[model samples]
Target: MTAKHAFHLALLVVFMMVAPARAEDLRAVMEADNARWLAAYNANTPAAFPAMYAKDAVLLPPGSQPVNGNEAIGKFWEARLKPGDKKDHTFEIVSIHQDGKYAYQVARWTVVVVKDAGERTRFSGNTVRIFERQPDGGWLTKVHIFNADK
Candidate 1:
């Protein structure tokens, strides 16, 4: 093989090796974002979600109409976050893929709800989120959808 061809093949090999590392990095970032969201939810407030979403973001909750924009999404969360509810929430991230300015996550979530009446229930669901890379090196949720496990 020509020296130039060998060099090009080596470069291609290196680039191919780096792609998985980049995806791993993106997964870490997405997991951190999930942690922040869980922290806010555990605090019994929907304060973090709207801020994490883009201005024109869309939320599709199961059995409900589509929620458009941050304001509506904020309200949707507000209605669900109870003041004194005890809940243990977790995210099971299945995959994360990134391309240029966009990244998407396929994940599952489980929550254990404990009410004041000692009623306990466990709920699990699947979630998908699409995030857009901001100019400031941050990510904003461009689309979010959740479906309860049957």
Candidate 2:
């Protein structure tokens, strides 16, 4: 092939390789996802939270059984939001990383709860969320893993 044609083809390849990952733009999407999590907590609703996860998502806590699937996760949060169960809660996002079709977020979360006998308990944990891109151009959690930082 001619030298001009070869140079043009090379340039096209370089542009295509760099186009998909606009590094600065991913932060916004990550921020929005982090905000969504906090909103779900404030509303005490599991629907939106679990919807952020894939259908076969898996949640691994620091010291507990794995919570599998959207339904079970929804049920767990619904119960946690019941009266005399939990009160004030907040989540602080620490960092987010985006690469191709996957991303991870780290955050610290705190919550106050009341027991059946009216005793109060306060706890906090560091959480890491792993997300995968969906076919519809949305992101969903493929794995939710966290540990108690205290």
Candidate 3:
């Protein structure tokens, strides 16, 4: 084979080897982000919640106006999550697709909220979240929208 052809073949082989590795790295980052989210929720501190999102994040919860910005999101959670509210939440990642600096994830979530009075309410839903890679090489949710299953 010509030297030019050999060089092209080697480059192709290198790309094939690197592509899957990059994808795996991205998946790992996304999984870590999910874990962090679960931890933040379980921590039950509204102050700890907004750090999981970008400064310009928007949250679209069912039947509520969109909550924009990190501060607003934090306040929203603080208002709804009372001090004695017990929450058990779990997330199952359905799919995650990445493009350049952004990724969208479809996940199924189940949450059980037990009030101070021992009343339990269960909420299960599907959520789609758009995550942007921050300048510091961390992923944060940019847009989060979820609806409950009736």
Candidate 4:
């Protein structure tokens, strides 16, 4: 092979080796993020979430108006969530993929919400989260949408 062809072949081999590792890393990072997200939500700390998102992030929740921007999203959640509201929650990541500078995660989520008025309800649903790769090489949620299963 010519020098150029040899260089291209080596690059291809490197990519072949790196791609699987990237997939593994994505899964681990997504799992860690899921844990953080659930902890924040169950803690009733709406203020804790906006920083996990991009400045222009949007949150599309079920049976509610679309929440725009990181700040608005935080406020929207704050209005509905109270301390001791969430009794339990889980995020079961179904699939995750990264393309270039974006990664998307599909997860099955469940939560048991407890009301101060002595009401409890369990909800389970699916969520799709799109994360944008940041300049610091971290990921921030750019778009997050979740709906409860009827």
Candidate 5:
């Protein structure tokens, strides 16, 4: 083989080895994002919740049409999260994959909510989320879709 060809092949091998390590690092970042999301939901502050999404993000909730943009997303969450309600959220990541500036996660989530009379409702679902790496070197959700496990 030509020396130049061997050099190129070595470079390719190095890139392939480094790629998986980078993906692992991204997985850690996504896990942190999931934790932040749960915290935001528990806090019951709609404003804080939408900050996890990109400015032009979209949310696809079951039995509903798509909601676009952070402002609209915040309003949607606010309507559902009343001031006096208590909510708990748990997320278990099934898988996370990344390609270039984009990554996606499949996770199972459970949420329990209690109302004024201690009436509790529980919902569990599987979710798929698409993330984009922002210019500021942070990750934000670009698309989020989830459905109930019922």
Candidate 6:
């Protein structure tokens, strides 16, 4: 092969090698999802939040019924947002695992809520979220399990 041909072939090979890193890299997907989740909660727009979830999504929230599907999950958040008030909130991702079209991630979170009687309630939890790659090249959450840490 000519030098020009060899150089072109080498560049093609390098591009192919880097395709997966850009296409399905788990870390980037997880980080983006984490940011979106934080934004959703801060916006207090639960109705619009479930659109990020897949059609068959399920949520296992601590101390409550298991919420299934986008509608149910959206309802849960809407109700929670209506509560007295919340503060001292924070969240961070712990880990992420990608397997083909599916992925799972863990996030640590904490929140403080104040009631009418001037009472303060503190809560901490870990959230495990499962995601699936959609046909349209987007990641949608499939399952979300929240467990209290204290």
Quick one: best TM-score, which candidate? 1
State TM-scores per candidate.
Answer: 0.94, 0.70, 0.86, 0.85, 0.85, 0.75
| Model 3 CA deviation exceeding 4 Å by range | 1-3, 115-120
Report clashes for each candidate as comma-separated counts.
Answer: 0, 0, 0, 0, 0, 0
Give the per-residue Cα lDDT of candidate 5 at 121.
95
**lDDT for 144 (candidate 4):** 98
**What RMSD, rounded to one decimal, does every model reach?**
1.3, 5.1, 2.0, 2.9, 2.7, 4.2
Q: Model 6 off-target regions past 4 Å?
A: 1-24, 83-88, 114-121
Candidate 1 per-residue lDDT over residues 1-113, each given as its tens digit: 99999999999999999998998899889999999888877787787779989999999999999999988898898899888888898999998899899999999999988
Would you give me the overall lDDT of model 2? 0.78
Least accurate 10 contiguous residues by lDDT in model 3: 37-46
Model 3 agreement with the true structure over 2-29: per-residue lDDT tens digits: 9999999999999999988987887787
What candidate 5 gets wrong by more than 4 Å, as runs, is 1-20
Q: How far off is residue 28 in model 5, in Å?
A: 1.2
Against the true structure, candidate 3 reaches a TM-score of 0.86
> Which candidate, 1 or 4, has the higher TM-score?
1
User: How would you encode candidate 6's per-residue C-alpha lDDT over 58-92 as one tens digit per residue?
Assistant: 98988888888888888888888844454456678
lDDT of 1: 0.92
lDDT tens digits, residues 1-150, model 2? 999999999999998877656544566776787778767776667777778888898988777799999777777677657754556677677877787899887888887776678788888998888889999999888888877756
Per-residue lDDT value at 116 in model 6 = 68
Q: Rank the candidates by lDDT, best first.
A: 1, 5, 4, 3, 6, 2
Q: Is candidate 3 or candidate 5 better by TM-score?
A: 3
Residue 75 in model 6: shift from native, Å?
0.5
> Candidate 4, residues 1-150: lDDT per residue as tens digits?
899999999999999999999999999989988888888888888898888888999899998778889888888878877766656889998999999999999999999887878798999999999999999998899999999999
Residue 34 miss distance in model 5 (angstroms): 0.9
lDDT (10s digit) by residue, model 5, range 30-136: 88999888877888878886788898999999999999998899888888878888998899999999888999999999999999899999999999999999999
